[model samples]
Target: MSYEVTGKLVAKYDTVQRTETFKTREFVIEKSDDIGGRIINNYVKFQCVQDKTALPDKFNIGDDIKVSFNLKGTKWSKDGRENYITNLDAWRLEAAGSLAQTAINNAPDNFVPDAAPDDVVDDLPF
Candidate 1:
């Protein structure tokens, strides 16, 4: 499955050449949320593989962006020990402002119009 996240770009790391034909680049983003009147910040890391490794080059630090990625997990066994790893493989990215505008543009065209002004009245009993 795929998931999307929006946050401010915090860091971009150099691409790693794992082998003759494999490469990967990693980047981090910071997301803040308010919970119980307190603010919490989360630093999330995502990776782009092969051709997508250049994905982060178009954006600068502190730029707000939306990333679309796939959740990947791998299990390995060595020396009678088991280990699991997880990765967010990013495939698509765009500026947060453009993302919001795209959502508005894609809204349904059959939206209902507001009631006529003549039909509106102060009918509240309060």
Candidate 2:
């Protein structure tokens, strides 16, 4: 399965040549969310393998991007010990914008809101 997230590009790492035919690059993105009146920031790392390693080069640091990636997990056993690892394998990227922004941008220039109903009162105490 594939998933996507929108965040600001934070860091990009050099590509690593694992072997004669294998190469991989990693990049990090920062996502912010508001919870309980506090802002929380998370840094997520993603990997691009082989030809996809150059994906990060298209965008500069601080750029807002939407990344589509696959969640990959591997399990290894060595010396009677078991270990598991997870990776976000990025495959696609694009500029980030909210759905509302897209809608407003696509709306016609002559568009206008309808008038409020007569029975509806605007009185409210805040």
Global CA lDDT of candidate 2, please?
Answer: 0.88
lDDT tens digits, residues 33-113, model 1? Answer: 999999999999999999999999988898889899999999999999999999999998877876556655776775323
Pairs that collide in candidate 2 are none
Q: Report the lDDT tens digits of candidate 2 across residue range 8-123.
A: 99999999999999999999999999999999999999999999999999888998888999999999999999999999999987766654366558879755423368755566
Off by over 4 Å in 1: 98-126
Residue 14 CA error for candidate 1 (Å)?
0.6
lDDT of 2 at 21: 97
lDDT (C-alpha) at residue 27 in model 1: 99
Local accuracy by lDDT, each model: 0.90, 0.88
> What 10-residue stretch in candidate 1 is worst by lDDT?
107-116
What TM-score would each prediction reach against the true structure?
Answer: 0.76, 0.76
